[model samples]
Target: MLDDTLKSQLKAYLEKVTQPFEIVASLDDGAKSQELHGLLTDIASLSDKISLNLYGQDSRRPSFALNRPDQDMGIVFAGIPMGHEFTSLVLALLQVGGHPPKVTDEVIEQIKGLDDALHFETYYSLSCQNCPDVVQALNLMAVLNPNVSHVAIDGALFQDEVEERQVMSVPSIYLNGQLFDQGRMSLEQILAKVDTGAARREAAKLNDKPSFDVLVVGGGPAGASAAIYAARKGIRTGVAAERFGGQVMDTMAIENFISVPHTEGPKMAAALEEHVKEYEVDIMNLQRAVKLVPATQPGGEHEVQLESGASLKSKTLILATGARWREMNVPGEADYRNKGVAYCPHCDGPLFKGKRVAVIGGGNSGVEAAIDLAGIVGRVTLIEFMDEMRADAVLQKKLKSLPNVDIILGARTTEVNGDGTRVNGLTFEERASGEIKRLDLEGIFVQIGLIPNTEWLRGSLVEMSERGEIITDAHGTTSVPGIFAAGDVTTVPYKQIIIAMGEGSKAALGAFDHLIRS
Candidate 1:
């Protein structure tokens, strides 16, 4: 049963649904099925426009019997939808109940015009904040086109299929039996994959030789800021990235972006892209920088080779490649990722509000996460593998002041224990006594360290720190004259969004200075 606040909100939303829609539950007499039935019944009770139907496996209708033979429009709930996925279920109902898809008109027209049969199978976990975006997008796509059909499967309920497909993360999408994408993706990205044949041919025939005055290697917050600043100078600027938004996309809520009180990662990422598009900056998405060849002469252009058999040349370069979170490589850790194990505390902390959680590592990041989560969650357990905590004295003092926080030192995480659905507990061993203990927790945040995305820069002239971070000066200038580094990938003292944006601006100004002097 939902709380009064949530039920009120859902009832209000359902009341606005004008069209009639049916939610079908395909299950036998099982506890999971019974729970799902109850949830659907409650949802259906909100409005007369919504109806709930139940069918056993033997009586289930074939996919071909639906509106479109090639597609199945029957919305089925195979298991209980809780956590973030509850939003997916509600949104699906609203979308199917006559709410228009929140996409561009051209995109809608393109989807409507498609005649080929397209089916999508998306696997998601209830706790994964990012999974709902992909699930909702695919569901909306199905609603928009008769030729397109989609099934949103809870990964925990379908562990066999997950293991068969080797899915280690949430929002693992498969199109027509082939893996399309494994993480959060926009609707346009999914459409591109649907037209894979045409896209491949187009990519092969693309022969345009691109050149720029200043080229940014990454499309994260830092790189986006650099490109925006450089483009404001009216110079040819280009930004290439594996994806825009970088680590920000994985983050949930961002409150420290300066001036803005609170914002989500995906929202901020979209804003960054929208702001960048306002300028004349050339954006290349889904492109990875493979190699960097520095210029031979002072004013000569440097070449950036890409993994996609494309190249871009520029007089100055800004390496804004971002960093990723370090993982805890223990049993069930990868399997339960997004299910219960998470990395970005800011993004996922609110999801675990009033629940018991744990923080791995006793470093500053771990301590900070514990402090932040203690206010929201009921209880927080801080575990350190070392004999003592490595966080600062001030942070330690603050942590000690928190009554809800429990600290355990010299504790090594042995394994993450969970049902096939979500994490319930974890096993840890004390170093001194070799005694094993278990803590029943709803979620675990791993914040040991960060690894810079600078592996491709190996053997290059750019100097790197012992930890592989790109060494940069106060002005964001690297060892090479025309090259500059910024953001978490560089030797910056902090890795905040505001700090990265400032560094990006500094790097862009530095590049402009070098370009004019040359």
Candidate 2:
């Protein structure tokens, strides 16, 4: 298995590398040292098609990068492929050899048709053992289709990036240019978001506005709930949102909300809308509040202007505008969106049943979605670019226990793949080994992070957090008198529907009190 030239080169290199390591063998019998020597020898004997290199510390890992000759399969080994790490090592090597372990044929076909470049970046920590499931989901998706690619970043290694990206927790995914999801996800759930992101990006380029009283800017659960409560209070309310339903719409389900055992983001949004319509809330969907110049006061009423050349006067104003998904702005992501793209699992998971899907991010949401989709899809793959998962210890334990989950550390998605009709696959490059491989998948789910949508009111009377989240008092009052804000747009700890609804109701009542007093 060892050619003379390659063997000599590896032998010479290992002599220096393994000096500090525990050497179980010499140039004679097969032991730890000899095994490593043999592995390197095999790498050298392989054809030029295989790209092998070292990652991490040369003194420690001394791994290799393997690339298949025909398929876009590849692997980057950071440590010796034996013992506890052997399964991961062998499986990764097999995937590079065009033999993905358990992906179904249907999922593979769906992935093959994808020509777009799917790029994903996953973030996690080494301390998180529950991260493997998310990685496996992405891998299955990649195996079935070779168009999508993935990258797993170790949070501890990229400390600067983690802080710069505002990664508050583990298991965060980024799809295309924006933060997709921020928790656990399944293969199908990941695919669903990819399709939804594609559809919206293709058709949703602008925001159209309409008329109403007490116009609310954000559309998070709080803002939507505010509109509903305001309408119920016999107040004419107009809710304008850049993305309807705000942060809650991006969530997969709601477990803590009262009166509902479990509810998905879109379902909760729809119900809230229905309730609002029962009163008198006019929803201006897909419209963003780009400007918020306080209208000239007349008869003690305050008026505001909109970017769409519209103006409205109301006795009170509620800034319920929510947040936006953060973006990576990395190369290749924008060119192949929707082809093998995504952002929200609850919005599009069903489209990828029995299909391979990738969930990027190593946070709670990323883990949760991956687990949920595993039950319905043929396979679920998760890619965390971080060294470990940082989810709550309990949740992390559950993720590790899943049967179909896979985890990849120190990798990143460099491209997306699709053939125009839908998504096909992805390409991943190892940050440490510099090995690039393509994965085929029907869909991808991104769970990166959220950005508060407060750009319009940057210099306004409202105070804001560093992340652009609106700042509010205990009573939902903004810095400006007669102005109140609530929901995801504000700096609330738990961004849930029930919490938003309660906050929105409180803001509406606060506005009413202000109006009465004024």
Model-by-model lDDT, in order?
Answer: 0.80, 0.60
> Where does candidate 2 stray beyond 4 Å?
1-213, 228-236, 241-252, 280-287, 295-308, 346-356, 375-379, 392-395, 410-442, 459-461
lDDT of 2 by residue, 256-311 (tens): 78877886665676577667667667665545466665544532455555554445
The sequence of per-residue lDDT tens digits that candidate 1 reaches over residues 1-518 is 66678778999988767777666556566667666666767788888987665653523221111112233464444346677677777777777777666667977876776778878887776656677778777777778776777777776666566657755456777878997777788676777667655345434533374678999999889999999999999999999888899988887668877899998787788899999999998887777888988888788888887876767888999999899988888999987887789786654665566779999989988998899889878999999999999999999999999999999999999999999878899999999999999999989999888889998888779999999999999889999889998999998988899999999999999999998998
Instruction: Quote each prediction's TM-score.
Output: 0.72, 0.52
As a TM-score, model 1 comes out at: 0.72
Task: Please identify model 1 stretches exceeding 4 Å from their true place.
Answer: 1-119, 144-147, 154-169, 172-181, 188-209, 327-359, 367-382, 390-408, 411-445
